[model samples]
Target: MTQFEALFDGRSFAAILFDMDGTLLSSIEAAERVWTRWAAQFGIDARTFLHGIHGQRAVDSVRQLNIPGVDPVAEAHAITLAEIEDVEGVHPIPGAREFVSTLPEGRWAIVTSAPRALAVRRLAAAGLKPPSVFITAEDIPRGKPDPACYQLAARQLGWTADDCVVFEDAAAGIRAGEAAGAPVVVITATHQRPMDTRHPTYVDYNALGATIRPDGRLQIRSQSTRKI
Candidate 1:
């Protein structure tokens, strides 16, 4: 469904919470290179490994893989270090910078499964500044699909679930935002939209527009139910 515009009727949020990798940064190629190499070393299928790890903490993913003789924490650390150095191909998703920059200062944040150092590196490499409030894997006790990361971000921003909206691209992240009780959800197809998808979706951040309401909350306008 294509359209020139659409209406996104929810905007009472005081802040917006965003996922990192797929939502904002276009780092799949970089991640693929690293994970593929790692998977090769472990005799694991890169496709399956990467799919299983999406939107998860590196340590958590490592544990889930159940790779024998691998120290999950140490492995995650090594991966993070490698990812930090693998800055090639890191860039912003289309319309990401323009849309994110339009957000009011201190009214938005990034909640990512990437460790703080790696997240910082990617944002820098992508030329996008991390917002004032960033909740990384290191700060999270649980990653996406747990809601802890999203809830933590809202709380740190002095907002609650309904007071913030979430923009996510991955299934785990969508679950996290929903679990966090975010009132408005914007699902981006930065990675790929699922066939059974059940959320307002966008091709990129350009599908959204924002204007401050009289009450000071942003009126997040978006195209209606169009597959983007």
Candidate 2:
């Protein structure tokens, strides 16, 4: 088990919120596949395109592609649809299903940048049927790094931001959670390196393990191993 797995031994956190893409579902490969195909149609380098917008919204990514005369919104929609249709090998992160099952049903929800359609597809692929309070890209006027998504989710859960613990795999999502005043837990799926530990409010789940206690406080246990 990772350090994160060990941290859940005997601590307490009220509610847990998760980001969908890299946090819970492995949609990076599927995303890259669809994005590369779209970039090729515009004669752009796929790797360059992917690196340039690794954590951006679809519309933001499309606009950054800088393809002359392209309608970013329409292109984003098309590519997103294509990605949903072509999705393969998409699955939940390790221990994700068990973790969710252990938590209180209404105490957890997904707050993701993916549109509802693609989110649904990816969640189904991961064999996860989330609670009804899912907050998608469609639900927010602004995306990650804006804190709107996290704020909306907290409101829907009827919990204050401080009572919520956010599980995120992206730097942008982490920032968003912090901005929303939630304690942020970094799930080390995509981001492998250790982040700055100066902030006490921010903890790496990769370093401390997590588990749901009988009382519903997420137990975070610190282990000998540094990496989660």
Candidate 3:
């Protein structure tokens, strides 16, 4: 077992980039419903299908699954529509709204592989306001593990990738953050087993022991750890 603290010691992270689904929002069950239904249609194990899709772009995941004669485009569209309409299990992660609201304008943004409309719905359902500038899969040239989204997010915030800290909860997101030249902070909300990244991982935002300092900087004190 290894332990590490995140970049939350009032460091000079000018901005924070967040991934939506498993990071800021606990929308796993909602996502699972979509994937599981697809799995059944393809005669695949639900567990394996779900395991393979986390932190992935819907289109990419659909294409990768390549379920025999399944049309990736049609499959991706169906799943996305289903997810946008279903809010039964969608909610913000603990401490997510509190911590995020404390950030200064332009200091934080959401960069997710979900479509803009779906992202908006999830945020509204969770009672969290979306930042002025939100980046969605539709806006990016490529998905996570490609770094295009994170890099574009940094650009939108008028900052360099190195000036931000990225909060993510999936393998692909971690790789994207690292590739974008930002320090990655992994939230262990999605990955049941040990995360594959060597970056600092925390259970959730509440684990940051986060508080707003008088100087408008974040003060953090937490003993968060991850097995890997």
Candidate 4:
């Protein structure tokens, strides 16, 4: 753990990239509710089906499933609509709000698999203000596990991927971050079980803090206090 802390102890970064759903907030309950219903409607086992789909764009997940007689685009649209209507249990991950609040505007961005409207709605539901640079499903032709979205996000922030750090909570997002050539930090906020990964992991942002250096680089720090 000491060695892991050493990675970010005094390092500075050009920008920070975040994945919205699981990283910034815990929307699993709400999302799974809608997906479970969608699975039932399509006669697919929700448990097995959902196991492999996190951090992927809905349309991409639908197309990959290739359900007979189902139009991937239309089905994805329906699912998105259902998700937008269900924010019942949506809430920010512990310490997430505080961590985000400390970030300077324009030094951070959100890259999500959700559509623009859905992303906005969920962020609002979770009591998180949307960042100025938000990359959503409609903004990218490809989704996670593909590095394009992360790369695009870094470029949007006027930095290269090598200069940014990505905070992710899903396997696909982690892969995307690594592939994009950025350091990845795993957030276990929404994990049901321990995940197998080499990246430094944090349960929440309670022990995390950050500040902008005089040179404008973002410095990530570990703290002993929690902010409610």
lDDT leader: 4
Ranking by lDDT: 4, 3, 1, 2
Per-residue lDDT for 1-228 in model 4, tens only? 463565676689999999998999988898889999998987888888786667989988888888999998999999999999999999999999999899989999999999999999999998999898999999998899899999999999999988999999999999999999999988887888888887788888988888889998999887542111
How many Å off is the CA of 23 in candidate 1? 0.4
> Please, what is the whole-model Cα lDDT of each candidate in the order they appear?
0.80, 0.74, 0.80, 0.89
Q: Residue 43 lDDT in model 3?
A: 83
TM-score winner: 4
Backbone steric clashes in candidate 3, count: 0
Q: Which of candidates 3 and 4 is the stronger one according to lDDT?
A: 4
Candidate 3 lDDT over residue span 1-228, tens digit each: 334433444465667899998899888888888788877877887886677687878989888876778888788888889988887888888888888877777778899988888889988988889897799989977888899898888899888887888889888888899999998888886566875667787777775654555765444456555443
TM-score of every model versus the real structure: 0.91, 0.84, 0.88, 0.95
CA-only RMSD, every prediction: 2.6, 4.0, 2.7, 2.7
lDDT string for model 1 (1-228, tens) is 322222244436688899898888878888888888887888888888677676778888889888889999999898888888898988898888998888888889999999999999999998899999999998877788999998898898888866787888777888888888884355555555353456666677766777778888866766445554
Candidate 4 residues lying further than 4 Å off, grouped into runs, are 1-3, 224-228
In candidate 4, the residue pairs with backbone N, CA or C atoms under 3 Å apart (3 or more residues apart, or in different chains) clash, namely none
Q: Would you give me the overall lDDT of model 2?
A: 0.74
The worst-scoring run of ten residues by lDDT in candidate 3 lies at: 1-10
- Candidate 1 is scored at a TM of 0.91
What is the Å distance of residue 149 in model 2 from its true position?
0.4
